[model samples]
Target: MTFSHDPVEEVARALAASGLLLRGGFSLGEDEAAPAGLSGAPARSILLIGQAGPAPWPHFQRWRERQARDIANPLDSWSREVIGAVAKEFGARAVSPSDRPYLPFQQWAMRAEGLKPSPLGILMHPTYGLWHAYRGALLFENGLGLAEPHAAIHLCDTCVAKPCLKSCPVDAYSGQGFAHEICLGHVRGPHGATCRTAGCLDRNACPYGTNYRYPADVQAFHMAAFAGL
Candidate 1:
């Protein structure tokens, strides 16, 4: 199955300009959740696309500056626009994490990248930590023959301190689950400036991947959106 060009390299090149990296992908199994491709047939492979940290911030900001105020889900919209273009170029279908009746992205992510959820319920990467995200995926009718994903040590398992749980001002996360109202209210309130400007105290406390952590401005943008502010 020789080709004129390497599909993976070509796809990666298309997304690199937008600060989206190919997070790795997998060939769909017969029993796995199969999303329809552009041709409306079940897709055979999926290449996850996302940012490691603040890589997409500049691109997103450029796009945002041109938009009217109060645009809904600006980041998601940007992701779709960027990823959709790459998908169209490759004759693939694009899907986002925010898609309704959402595909099992988390499930697929763990399978594709050997990630597991942290105490904060965000997928914890050994190197990228919680700072990374799965923005969108390109679903193809034929396999791209991507390399197999490798397993890594789950950082949460060995961390005895577990600072992520204790740093939240309102104790928003717990064994029970995230306290949405409590967390939202605090971020939107006056005293929430620390979190609003810096980012989730809990997520920031995870010492595993501090090198890849998001900057304050990037965190502020997401926090503002989360608080509807």
Candidate 2:
């Protein structure tokens, strides 16, 4: 189907209504390598889409609750369906971060939004801070004039407090890298109840995006998932 409006704005608006954001996008050169599953597709451009903050949490929570009645992996399934529908509307292919062969979502986000990693390794958004996430992306056969890459100031470079490093009781994060096993063990232990209920202390300790922090239920959901509950 032919689009009468600017496809990028149209898609962005539609996604926004669903509590998702069209984070940014970029054009892929003809010779640039495509990710594993997309090698055969005539993909020319990509639109990075995702939830930015707590604005999407209520919508997502309702969706999850409804989907949980009958669906396993509600979060992934919901995200795929939402992104898939948008792709179909725009005559593009939908790809998710959770997809096999794992698309370079972090690299894509960095390139698309000019983001840098926080101490915890999560990409620190200029405005959203550590509260944003890339749920999925849309690929089209034809190129759309995507937004220019942002030259946002890297917030971490100036923050002297760096509370994310000091707040984790288990010291799960450090300059050396994340202690995954230690984090997992703590999350699974009784002492992790607070973390399980309120989300990672280190993540919550971030001072940049307190306004965008996920609500309690949403944070609890993520923590439970992290703890494998």
Candidate 3:
């Protein structure tokens, strides 16, 4: 049966109905503005940022699984699949961030389509407190505007410790940027200890969305991927 709803609205509804809350359109724009990592030749895109459902920790954990693979994070595969199906319905291709040069895209991504970080963290919420990730994005052959743009908010400006930078024992995130080799070292090392035990060092540090914690097994799986395992 042909789906009968506005594509963007349907995407938003589908995401919410799936127990995932949509972030906003600007985030997608930000990612696009950033160095796209092989998004299969960007045309225009309809951005959607979403997070797993909640109330039950297990469900929340299940949702975050979409971040990586190896173990059993259903969310990782689940979301990509969901996005793929959705994009197909709308004549678009889902793009995983890994397909392109990530770091080079960071600065632009940090400031996609004119969306900037705000004090309420309007730009930061929706997913993994900066620690969470873009496993991939849906690239539409044509860009479509949402019903309306997300209102600006300032959640991050109030943040004091900025623990996202300092919380890491190994200092994986430089705050100004990332330290890849050092991060992968522990992720793929003999022990593969702390990170596996906790989660992403920088990711865990973010104060936003205290509820979006990924289960231990899920965390381990993602770290393993980072190690190229």
Candidate 4:
């Protein structure tokens, strides 16, 4: 089936309808090298796909429900399946963040989207605040002539209050870096119920993109997963 729109645009539209977005992409050449582990599926370029804010939450939830009826690991499996289908449509190979020998998604995200990290270590999207997430990427054997990535203004720089640093009850996030043990302990404790049911307090405290915040149920679902519940 031939598509009238640009291949990237066509894929982006399809992904958007499914609650995903083409975050960005890059060509693999002399200046931009492909990762070593990707030898099994070498590609001339890669397209990074991700979930922006709560847009994909409902779609993901519905998919999760349907997949849960039969699959033991619905979320991961569903992500792989959806991204794989998209890759197939474009004649590319699908890769996920959860895959072994991790593909340096964070680095790819930073390079592909020119994004910076938030206080919570999650990449702070210029418009999505701390609510966005990378799902997977598509690797194509040839360049798609994707647009070049330019640095985005780091939103955290202009915020004088820096509420995210102060919102965590256990001080899990700060300039010193995340205290993983403390954060985990708090999430597993009795007082962690609030966080476990509503998501990270620090993340929720971010002033930017408030309208894009995930629904409480979606946040709670992620919190539950983080707490290993």
Work out the TM-score per prediction: 0.95, 0.93, 0.62, 0.92
RMSD of each: 1.6, 1.9, 6.4, 2.3
For residues 63-142, write the lDDT of model 2, one tens digit per residue. Answer: 77765465666777878988888878777788999888888999888888889899999899878889988889988777
lDDT score of residue 114 within candidate 1: 84
lDDT of 2 at 145: 74
Model 4 per-residue lDDT tens digits across residues 1-229:
2558788888898798788999999887856666532345457778899987778777777887765365555667777888988878877788999989888899889989999998789998888888889999988776678777999989999999999999999999877899988998999998898898888899999999787898889888787667777
> What would the per-residue lDDT of candidate 1 be over residues 126-197, giving only the tens digit for each residue?
999898999999999887777668887799999999999999989999999999999998999988999999
In candidate 2, residue 61 scores what lDDT? 71
Stretches of candidate 2 off by over 4 Å are: 36-39, 68-70
Off by more than 4 A, model 1: 1-3
Pairs of residues clashing in candidate 1: none
lDDT for model 1 comes to: 0.90
* C-alpha-based local distance difference test score of model 3: 0.53
**Best prediction by lDDT:** 1
Question: Model 3, range 158-194, lDDT digits (tens) per residue?
Answer: 6787777776667766535567788778776765577
How many clashes does the backbone of model 3 have? 19
* lDDT score, candidate 2, position 70: 57
Worst 10 residues of 1 by lDDT: 1-10
Candidate 2 local lDDT, residue 162: 90
